[model samples]
Target chain A: MDVFAFFNLNELAFGLSKLPMFPYFDMAHYIISVMSLREQPGALCVSQRSPLACWFSSMLYCFGGAVLSALMLADAPVAPLSNTTNLLLATLMWYLVFYCPLDVVYSLASLLPLRLVLTAMKEVTRTWKVLSGVSQAGSKYSDALFVMVAVGWAKGAGGGLISNFEQLVRGVWKPETNELLKMSYPTKVTLLGAVVFSLQQCRYLPIQTHHLTFIYTLFTVTNKTRMMLLGSSSHPLSSLESFLYK
Target chain B: MDVFAFFNLNELAFGLSKLPMFPYFDMAHYIISVMSLREQPGALCVSQRSPLACWFSSMLYCFGGAVLSALMLADAPVAPLSNTTNLLLATLMWYLVFYCPLDVVYSLASLLPLRLVLTAMKEVTRTWKVLSGVSQAGSKYSDALFVMVAVGWAKGAGGGLISNFEQLVRGVWKPETNELLKMSYPTKVTLLGAVVFSLQQCRYLPIQTHHLTFIYTLFTVTNKTRMMLLGSSSHPLSSLESFLYK
Candidate 1:
């Protein structure tokens, strides 16, 4: 038996592809939404906030990406909100994370082990969304690399891109906090992944989706693990970024 | 559609039961093992430790439950270590969590979102193991409720029970820090859960596995959430304990 075969990236990617991903994605997204909402300077404290306001803001943040993608591709803003079960689950998760007594859900969700898994799952979903967006746009434009990359980027980081809009919906205005000014690692990676995926779709690159998935997974996992371990103050990829830009 | 049916516990349990469990259990258990090992007063700092000693102690802590359970039931100490894949994965996780440069894995694993999910998975696995132990003992002993509960307790909390032995293996003997003197929430809950499961197995309680799973999950999720939110200093169930005892 070949020892190297046991660590095959293709095989690993195949196994990962088989796992049910949506639940992990939804949970991770909701957690991120709650965290982001809490970070908003204009947001009211949980104790002082109205339940309706909380639900509205959280739902907006949680479904921002899907809504944005739908609008970009289908010209329909309400497409993502049509699913009743998805809406209910999102609201339930948001409520639990933000309004649950003693803030138990938020506290537990913030723990390292759970956070690491959620972050990994979220990245996996981002990869999937980016590819899906590229394919969707390719079907329409069929050779417009720029459009495909733009759509893919939107699908992957639409939520972050729309943070200012989301905050506006919550009656807060912070134009300076727009994602473009302070691009997150996820947003940056998504843009880069979008470009590569777009190139592949246009026959400029010859990589398989699973191969890309494997590479993206490896990259995100290493970076996320480092970020979690080193504390948020220490940039996990700063050294790599410096070397690349230098 | 009846809105109440949407929140059915049985349906929820069935859904949860269908999800892949072992991966979550294994990951959660490894995180817990890494944490407990780090807490040991006799253990050397990661930077000061030999790789071999670290591997030995971590593997021992990680597999202590299975090894102890095998001794109690199958009378074979090495039965659990027979699988090379399980051993390799365990060692890999142990190495990453404990010995990874910059403590990245440990930091990532400690994050709340990931920790919450892992802890929930751990409790779910605990409930399963407790029931399994009760059923296994009942099949052999036929009418020994005490024996069933004892085996169940051992199965659920065996890792903690053998911590002193694990420490001794690491060249650190601290009889005072035994699990009996400092019973953690999981250990206490496991014992209680074991007794209840034993009763159910003996036909004394008119409940099913899924029902117990639902209840156990609810209980632990609530308690764990509270514990996480209130910080470790706040005893989540202390108020309830006082009320019940009084």
Candidate 2:
């Protein structure tokens, strides 16, 4: 089937599996109550309010990443089968069903009413600050086991990205064809124009969300009307975005 | 017409459009080099043998990231085609070009040859420590910027993977013929096994380099002889261990 069906199935399974840990939901509820007393953005303020929330957020954040990495490692097919729509849906569902309770608890706790919650949150932030300091230290001077791992990975990602980008360019042009320079002139000009305009402006030129929505809705209605007109199963032309994804 | 063709066309168009001032290529080279050096198990000790090399490497390391980010902001087709392969190529190319130049510069500038280079390298490494300290100062914590960005993206990736994995499992069933529970039995059991295994053993599984290579290679190659072989392409898939600019 399509992506959404796959997501729905998996989400149902994941939800069912977590049914036994229902009590932890209460812990999240309590945490939310505590957070509700604190100030907005007071994740690390300190006293009791700051530490609990800060620790909770930090643990959740890291745990969330670890879980994601683990899942990928666990044999998930990641081909862009349908424009990442299925993948996005599946992840969103998991977040709502599995991670939401913890997040809600944290969010609620952060919104706690304690006068000193901000103070505690500040300290909590400080504790996170210290850990980062350790990583920075490791990154710079070397020797911190954790830093080494983090930096090594970061470096690798950096190197890999650069290398790949260059190869892509080289691969596009046949050595004999000067096709590198010859491929459709209009396409080249459009690409160049876009690049120059972007560089000069240093601004994003994304189509507005509303514009996209309008277009998609318009396209859908047009397609349905066309089907009615033709009384046929065939589509007139493939959608631009859908074609690109495939 | 194919994925590689599309990717290469995008890269060449992007690269050519920003000609004369190919700042990105320069930046990627330096950034990846530095990050790689920083992450090396014993980067500092190695610097003793070649201070100029260390200096050059660090420069390349920082440069790669800045360039990649810069490239992203450009309105080129590069953004869409930036899969793992392109990322690796960009960074690797940067290293190949800049590595020797940087080494020569460092060696020539040093007064006492080896000993002086070592001393200079130590002094440079100390700069990072100073930078970390500055970030960790009483109330103004700056290190969180990188960690938050890194961790935030990881969370997003993880969330995506979890959702997608669920869908993959759900896809295994013939929806018309099978009920949810019937289909879920094996899937649920497998997930449960994973959960228990993860919780007790502290092992979270996600595919690593081996699998990435397997899938990417699978996509590119089309023969039985290819099936029996495992060779490194001039470019390869990006990993958590790879650099952003690469």
Candidate 3:
């Protein structure tokens, strides 16, 4: 009997996708943007920064997923500031993360139990974006494998790809800081996933989207958990490589 | 015009209630259990602790809200170990928190961004438990305001109330560590909320359940945010009192 016969990957993927991950992903994106801006030299402090600049920087990061996917597919660039509720919530989250009195929100967010869930959910969000991007591109370019991969890759790692622009919007110029020079594990994994998805889309691989989702989710959750546990942002398997090679 | 006329708080409450908070709450409770066990002296470390004791202790915390509410309402003591999925997930979490090599899971959880979301969601879970407990008791004894309050209080602070028992299950009892003598701010707030909910049930207060939920959410979020920011587990308003009285 096939081991895979007992479990249905599609149903599992469907259930996982039903989770309320959008808000968590949105918040995670905003937090990353704010943190990235803060990390830049000569960037104004949260209190000193103009609200418009801060808001613009945040909008860029928070909506980068959608905007970049559209751009990758050569469609009209969807305006990032479309939803009022999303905008309001993002602004509130930005304020809380940076300006909450005594930095309480930041400290609470730093706790382990909460952090683990957010990180896990954020990965789930990335997987969803990558999958959607692949399908979206596939619909437009049915015969173009390269186009499908590129679109998915763009959707998955768009935030990083656009970091220079995001930073410029905040009046911080650091062209030296390119995502290409130091691609994050998530971005690399997304590229690989895009290729796999594109292959599957072109009938070169025999697997369902849900199957791919399950695989991606498993890989990411394990990788993230390992990264988080080791307290290292480096590749999750780097320790193994170091141990084996040394 | 009344400021309240501008908003449909009930709809807001309904929307908030729809959030996938159960899983987050369940995980938060399990994390707290493991943390509490770790904090005790003479207790075996996670790796050393018997799996039975760990599971039992975690189950007590994870299912405390539901079980305590049932008990308070004079219902049969619900079996905590009924759900296989929840049990399996709790076990996995327990292992991850305790036995993950290098304590990486714990470290990731210690981060600010993720922690804040978890803490906020946990408070939302608490507010939900209190409301449900109030209604559960109210149904059985419609005119019994005291019963409603008691049930709500138990549901809200049942984990603390049963902490001693939980520790005892781990073979590390500490009678001096009574919850009442050192009541947490959450417990105090829950007590106040219980009274308000009970009053509302008894028709002495003019407010809907959603209205109370809105108030509770606002109060807890602000209070927890303050506490987390100050890095003090003390009451959120204590600083205000010190400033005023000083």
Best by TM-score: 1
* Model 1, C-alpha of B181: deviation from truth (Å): 53
Query: Best candidate, lDDT-wise?
Result: 1
DockQ, each predicted model: 0.01, 0.02, 0.01
Q: How does each model score on TM-score?
A: 0.47, 0.21, 0.46
**Cα lDDT of model 2 by residue, B1-246, tens digit:** 244355565454334333332244333333333443444555555455655555444433333222222222222223423544544554454344335455653344333443233332322222222222222221121222322222222221221212222222223212121111122221222222223222222223343322322232233222212322433322222232146324
**Model 3 lDDT at residue B119:** 72
Off by over 4 Å in 3: A1-246, B7-10, B42-47, B236-246
* All candidates: TM-score of chain A: 0.87, 0.17, 0.84
Ranking of all candidate structures by their lDDT, best first: 1, 3, 2
Residues A45-71 of candidate 3: C-alpha lDDT, one tens digit per residue: 633657777767766666676677775
lDDT measured at residue B43 in model 2 versus the true structure, 0 to 100? 51
Q: Candidate 3 residues B33-97, lDDT tens each? A: 56555555644452363554565566677666666776555453333333546666777777777
TM-score for chain A as predicted in candidate 1: 0.87
Each model's lDDT comes to 0.71, 0.31, 0.69
Model 3 chain A: weakest 10-residue lDDT segment is A173-182
Query: Candidate 2's residue-wise lDDT over A84-139, tens digit each?
Result: 33223333332332236556633543343431343232222222222233344344
DockQ of 3: 0.01
